[model samples]
Target: MPKLTKYQRRITWSTGIGFILERMDAMFMSLALASIIITLHISKAQGGLLPAITAIGSIFGGIGFGALADRYGRVKTLCWTIIIYAIGTAGMGLTNSFWMLCLFRIIIGVGNSGEYGIAITMLSEAFSKKYLGRLSAAAGVCGQVGSIVASLLSAFILPRFGWHVLFFIGIIPVVLAWFIRFHLPESKEFTENRDAIEKDPNRDFSHWTELFATPAECFLTIRIMIMFMIHIAGYNGLISWLPSIAQERMNISVAGSSLWMIATIIGMSLGIMCFGIVQDHLGSRLAYGIWLLAAAASVFLLIIAQNKLEFLIGGGIVGFCSDGMYSGYGTIVSKLYPTEIRATANNTIMSIAKSVGSFSTVLIGFLMDHFSLMAVILFLSGIYLVSFVIMLSIKELKHENKAPVTTTENAEKVAQ
Candidate 1:
């Protein structure tokens, strides 16, 4: 591979860090769930609602920030999102009531989802199609690094100082916001479009309607949303419960759960890198087909394991298969949409899917209370097959030029 230019390198690192922070928030919430339940004296079902609430906030943030990014600028929107995430995360440390916790989680959700969409959209615009898959996957690998860090902190802090300190640690990502503000420039593609719209009064750039302007477009958007919903459901169903399952089933300590988490994160990083390479060489269809099936089979390992060694290795395989395909969502959305609505398309579909998926945490928690761990694992595994089938039907977008093809051409290509 050729070396990246200074700007490419900057965008890569900045977006990678953005993903890191996002993943860190998720991992912290998962790892800290047990402690939060005890501290707040909440039931498992209610505890599950916290992340769901955050997902609800993301729905608003994703749509709102996406429109703002298309209207204003990706970098400017991204900086504010990060600051919002930092503030929301910090506020969690001070809250003792469940409602207050819910409020803060919403803030974190909004910022987290916004940051995710803008960062991916910016990175997609910054690079060519040649490097899109791999660079996006690289940022995903960075997200795993964040998960690893959160796991370590969970092991060290949750047992020592408590979960409040964990929320305080979230405030640290604000430093990343500072660096992004000073160093990054706006995406050239976005800037060009903005200038064109400014120059031509006749050009109508209002984009939200274009998403559903026609039957075909609306159907395609729904198809993408369902696939992503399945993706999010499968992921959250397995990961959100893993730590708790290890503790309950295997009698693992908080620190030991961290070890399991680290092992899983290592697998996730390797899998994401490998998926990017595979998707680049092979088409997205074949690549997703393989990983989705692997995810279906691997999730069973979590339920059947009898020992720590089995669980540890099984967790890694599960992580590899399950989350390896996560970053591809961004790449796919960015490819399918034009510059004007790319951010909106990316955030709207993903956040809505996440909203649906996030609630699965609540459902899974309720299921675990009533059903067996095996039941939940079966649900997670079955959804992957559903996603795999969906992947086969949906066409991959392939654009050869920096300027994407016209909507007519895009539709024709998609049909082919």
Candidate 2:
């Protein structure tokens, strides 16, 4: 197997733990839904509010944590997010009311959402320019492993010990956070930036808004933001609704539905693994464009799929195309910005995209109630086509030996 350097391995494992724990919490929610409803005597609508509200909260968490990771340090801010995530998740186990679960999930959303940008930024900074794409993809692929683990863990824990114990398990990632703080070396770029900031505390490091200070910067930021929005909306809609879609389409029991999730998970993991290398071989826009197009085509197959075998195959292809492009986002955002606000750029945009895009769940639900599941899936396919068109508009920053997008002025130097 291809291996990372020692530094990359440490980063991979640390970030990977966050990914696993986060996905486990998410997957556990589906299994625990019945228990939660019965315990709290809440309506299905009220129960659904919890996840939606949590996603909204994560948008703020991402921006706030991204800024902190920029001004303070990536690892330190990341540790705080872990604490937040653990608290949010574990507290849910103790909730006696629906509102309390909503509150804790909001907290969890912030932490989980914030975790992605900071971890990706750190990995991008730690690796050399040459290794950036694959390592980041590896991190994303690790996240899908988290999903797969969640499915397995949910299958094991939910029936035996019940739901609360599963949430208490959320506390486990705190150990990983501790390891990151004590053992992992801070990124060299972050260390340099911290020193520079201390010497000149007056220097403004917040570049989330300043990203549009120039034409090239504005163009790049807007293009990627639009592209990521479509990606998140389409991907989240599919994953959230897929089990039901599969259960209905395939006429399977809840236990049997794991096959659908597993197939999708495998496809997603493979897609990211493939996209990571493809991004390096092809340039930024083309790599994304290809996958976005494939994603649309895959969804078309999913809607038309007639039998269990066809749907399973279509699910795998959709998962591969839809989620795999996530790795490319890290690659695109990493090269498009400099170290000073790199973390902020990655987190804020992604968080915003996710927050907005997550509404696809509600949208799909509405459409399904009125139209049909096939109609909703067809809508998703059209969204992917839109994403592909948006990808074409992006003017990529050339991956050069020079520090990529270090400053507004420097951004122009690498502009293609």
| TM-score of each model, in listed order | 0.95, 0.90
Q: Pick the candidate with the highest TM-score.
A: 1
**Candidate 2 C-alpha lDDT tens digits along 1-416:** 25567877777787777666655665667556545656788654555555567777789998888988888888778777877787787798886777788889888888787677788888888777667777778878777887787677666776677778878875775666667655577888888877876798556566577677877677777778778888878876776667656666788655556546888889999998898887776666667878888888888887688898888888888888888888678677877787888888999888888778767766776676678777887898899898888776664544433455556645444584
Q: RMSD to native for every prediction?
A: 2.7, 3.1
For candidate 1, write residues 1-416 as lDDT tens digits: 77778888788888888888888888899988888999889999998898788997899888888888899888888888887887898899997889999999999998888766778898888887767778889999998999998998889999998889988987786676558666478878888999987898656454655677777667777777887888888777666778999998999998888778999999999999999888777757777889999999999998778999999999999989999998888877787778878888888888888888889899899989999888888888888888888777775443322354235434565898
TM-score (C-alpha) between model 1 and the true structure: 0.95
Q: Estimate candidate 2's alpha-carbon lDDT, on a 0 to 1 scale.
A: 0.75
Which structure among the candidates has the greatest lDDT? 1
TM-score of 2: 0.90
Could you tell me how far off, in angstroms, the CA of residue 45 lies in candidate 2 after the best superposition? 5.8
Off by over 4 Å in 2: 1-5, 30-48, 159-162, 200-202, 397-403, 406-416
Worst 10 residues of 1 by lDDT: 397-406
